[model samples]
Target: MTIDIRPDDLTSPEMAELIAVHAQTMLASSPPESCHFLPIDGLRQPSVSVWSMWEDGALIGCGALKELGNGGGEIKSMHTRAHLRGRGLGRLMLDHILSVAKARGYTDLWLETGSMDAFIPARRLYESYGFSYSGPFGEYAEDPNSVFMHLHF
Candidate 1:
């Protein structure tokens, strides 16, 4: 697929709606009270950067990077539209996210993902990208449902 990945304003109408839909879907499919979906407005804070992926004019996926200061970064809200799952779109997204993290002089990249059967694939993907299991970072406290992973770039 001819995909184009670029940074986008989190407040863009299209992206805002897309993120809402993605968050709703994620929460709906999640357990009783999982807080897995990061809110769009929250991600629009000055320290964060968001990106949307497009393939031949169709939306493919979106991901965000947050500068955690001290040259550390975090990955937030990585999602591929349901219709376009598989076909290497995820690899593309990860590659782009990682490259962006590196360009910002981030020495470490970390992420928090749910630890559920639905998250197995995501865990696998992060491992494939060399992200290893680590203790929670940022505001997260250890939870049986949360898996923290990080990479030292």
Candidate 2:
């Protein structure tokens, strides 16, 4: 299958709907306070670069990398369409993110995801990429509902 991942301006109707679904899904799976998925406006920041992944022109996944200063970066808003979860789309997007981070000279990458069983797959995915458990970083604070991970390049 052919896959394409590229920078997205987050203006298309497809992206808007996908982002809405992503936020709603996160809120439904985790408490509002525990869900840290950024809103569209948040992802549009100057420091953040978002990418959309498509397979033969169909949007299947999307992810973002936010420059956190000092050669550090944060992975944010990673989501693959629900029905397409096991098809390696998430891994594709993740590999793209890591590649971009490394190419940009980022020394560290971090992410925060749900600690609930619903997120086990996600945690495992990150772990498989060499991300290790870590305490909260940047503006994040410790929370039982959140699991933070860090990867050093």
Candidate 3:
């Protein structure tokens, strides 16, 4: 199973559907105030770069990297199609995002994921990649429903 990860313009219908599904899942699992996944408009900002993962011409997952300036970056909108979980696609996309961050000379990477039981796998995934618990960065405030993490290169 070859999976291709490439830059996406956020125009494809499949991508739109995936983003909606991602949003729905996030909203359902976490409270509205704790959810931070970007909407399509937010992901389209010049500071953000989005990528889609595909297998055999079908969209499988998507993730984004947003530059926060001053050598800092943020991970956003990471989602693998529900049916395709456990296939290591998230790991692949994460490695891809890390490579991009390194190539851009980012000194640090931060992310905000839910602290809910439903988010354990995501937290574990980030932890596996060296992301340690951290105070909120960017505009985020400390919240019980959110788990903030940082990885420094």
Candidate 4:
């Protein structure tokens, strides 16, 4: 399948619905009290650029890049649709996002993923892309549910 990925308008109706679905999925995988899903409006901020991936005209996944200032960025809200998992789409999305970050002159890329079983795949993916475990960054602590990682680009 020819998957088309592009920068998206965060306020677009389709993108908004996609964000809602992603947030809901995050909540489903984690408890309400521990969930760190960012609301749609928070993701639509000026420093963040959201992107949507489509396969055969259907939304397959989405991700966002948040400028962390001083040549750094944080990857946020990366999710592939339920039906499209394990087809290497996740890797494709990761590669695209990292490329975008590099293109934007970001020298440091950091991310926060849950440390639960549900996040095992994410940790593996990040590791495959040279992201190593590090102390928690941003507003996170050393919680059992949070894994902190970073990659120097």
Candidate 5:
């Protein structure tokens, strides 16, 4: 598949569907209190940069990077369409976000994901990219259901 990853406007209809599906999937995997997904409005904030991956005019996946200032950035809203899972679409979107963060001069990248079985693949993917387990960063406090990871350059 020819996947094109590019910055996207969160208000677009395609993006709305992608984000909704992502939110639903996350909520299904973890309790509402433990899910930290950012809604579309939050992704549209000035500090966040969202991207959508498209192939043959279909939205395959999406991811976002939120600037935390002080040379730190956080990954948010990463999701691959249900039908496209296991096709490496998630990894592609992640690599795109990492490159963008580096281009923007971010010295570190951090992310929070669930500790449930449903999130194992995601944690593995991050680990493959050199992210190591880390303490809660930014505004996050310790949570039993949450796993925080970070990569420093």
Candidate 6:
């Protein structure tokens, strides 16, 4: 599949569906208090850069990078359509996010994900890309259901 990942506006109808699915998945995987998936409107904030992957003109996945200032960034809203999982699309999206963070001069990249079994693959993927376990950073607070990871360039 020729997947095209590009910056996208969160207001698109396709994006709405993607974000809704992402939100639903997060909620299903974690408690409401532990879910950090940002809503579509939040992803449109000036500090967040959103990207969507498309193949044959159909949206297949999406991810975002949030500028944290002081040369830091946070990965947010990363999700692949349920049918498209295990196809290396998540890795491709992550690689794109890391490249953009580097090009933007971020010295560190951080992310928060669920600590449940469902998130093991994601944690492994981040580890393969050099992200290591870390304490909560930025505005995040300690949460048993959350796992934090970071990579420094």
What overall lDDT, based on C-alpha atoms, would model 3 receive against the true structure? 0.96
Q: What's the TM-score of every candidate structure?
A: 0.92, 0.98, 0.99, 0.93, 0.97, 0.98
Model 4, span 38-121: residue lDDT tens: 688888799988888998888888888889999999989889988778888888888998999999999999998887898898
Model 2 lDDT, residue 144, Cα: 96
lDDT of residue 133 for candidate 5:
100
Cα RMSD of all models vs. native, in order, equals 1.6, 0.7, 0.5, 1.4, 0.8, 0.7
Q: Give every collision pair in model 2.
A: none
Candidate 4 local lDDT, residue 130 = 92
TM-score, model 2 to reference:
0.98
- After TM-score superposition, the amount by which residue 1's alpha carbon in candidate 6 deviates from its true location, in angstroms, is 3.0
Please report, in order, the local distance difference test score of every candidate based on alpha carbons: 0.84, 0.94, 0.96, 0.86, 0.93, 0.94
* Candidate 3 residue lDDT tens string, 34-82: 8999999999999999999999999999999999999999999999999
Query: Residues 50-72, candidate 1, lDDT per residue (tens digit)?
Result: 88999888777898888888889
* Global local distance difference test of model 5: 0.93
Q: Once superposed on the true structure, which residue ranges of model 4 sit more than 4 Å away at CA? A: none
2 or 3: which has the higher TM-score?
A: 3
Better of 1 and 4 by TM-score: 4
Instruction: Give each model's clash number.
Output: 0, 0, 0, 0, 0, 0
Off by over 4 Å in 3: none
Candidate 5 lDDT by residue in tens digits, 1-153: 588999898767988988999999999999999999999999989999999999999988999999999999999999998877899999999989988888989999999999999999999999999999999999998999999999998
Report model 5's TM-score to 2 decimal places. 0.97
Worst 10 residues of 6 by lDDT: 9-18
Who wins the lDDT comparison? 3
Q: 26-122 in candidate 2: lDDT tens per residue?
A: 9988889888888999999999999999988898889999999999999999999999999888999999999999899999999999999989999
> Which sections of candidate 6 miss by over 4 Å?
none
TM-score of 6: 0.98
The total of clashing pairs for model 4 equals: 0
